[model samples]
Target: MVVNEEGDILLVKNPNRGWEFPGGYVDKEETLQHAATREVREESGIEIQVTDLVGVEQISSKRLNVFVFKGRPISGELSLSNETWDVGYFTRGESLSKIKLERYKERLLRCMDEQNTPFLLES
Candidate 1:
């Protein structure tokens, strides 16, 4: 997830899944860092410097490899895209309540850790 200097969490209003951090599957021949930067730009129309690979969520039933990256916004204004309806920043406590899905909330919490230990969350 990308955060700004004010300690607000960035959220994208996904048309299908409600609110979530900007992320998607890595494209062919793309590095994880590149994928993250690309996803953020595509969903939120912002540039970010991906700081670290903070965690991974391994969902068995869905067979999804979700990589959680910590990032800071470097450029661009808050704009909407085809996949996301709204882009906004909120506080940690605010986001905790606003995010609709439990699993997505969990992912955001994991990535927000100050200690930055990589996690393997399975479900």
Candidate 2:
């Protein structure tokens, strides 16, 4: 998940564990982009526009659907929902240390380093 000039990647602090991108399982028929956007909004209360396909990754027991996009903050103030504890942006280094999901941290760094290229998935 990506956001504006602040370089703040939208993140949700999961109640069950640590921080993660605001994304969930894709519905049977929903496109990955749709899922990414919906998940971000649902979890972070921040509506974002998904611009490009970032990448995908599979870890341990789950298949992660990662989509890196340019998001413009549409509306809604950040709030902690049932699934998330906090929602905000942090610097790349900060996110690396603060993000709870190890895979997400890896992907975030990859996305940043490869921002000029198309999405590429890593297992």
Candidate 3:
């Protein structure tokens, strides 16, 4: 997931309930890093530079690759695409309730808890 200089985490409000990180399934030819960057731009109008791999989670049937990125809002105003209804930033506490996926909240908390160090996972 990507966070901008304002200390707000980027979130896409899914139809389900809460908001979500702007990312989707990886394309066949694209690398994971590129996929993350593309998905962020497509979902939210902001351009980002991915910096690090944060953590990974294996859900019931899906393998999720989560990356922690320190990015700047280089260009584009916020626009809601087909994948999202609202696109905005939220503080860590605000994100817990704002994020639609429980797993996402958990991951964010994990990242926050490990702020001083870096986290990496395989598989």
Candidate 1 RMSD to the correct structure: 1.3
TM-scores, all models, native as reference? 0.93, 0.80, 0.81
lDDT of 3 by residue, 1-123 (tens): 677787778888877655877877788998887888888889898888877666655443445555554455667778888888898988887888776577677667766665743565444
Count clashing pairs, candidate 2. Answer: 1
By TM-score rank, best first, the candidates go: 1, 3, 2
Query: Which residues of candidate 3, in runs, are more than 4 Å off?
Result: 63-70, 115-123
Top of the candidates by lDDT: 1
The best candidate in terms of TM-score: 1
lDDT, candidate 2, equals: 0.72
Give the count of colliding residue pairs in each prediction: 0, 1, 2
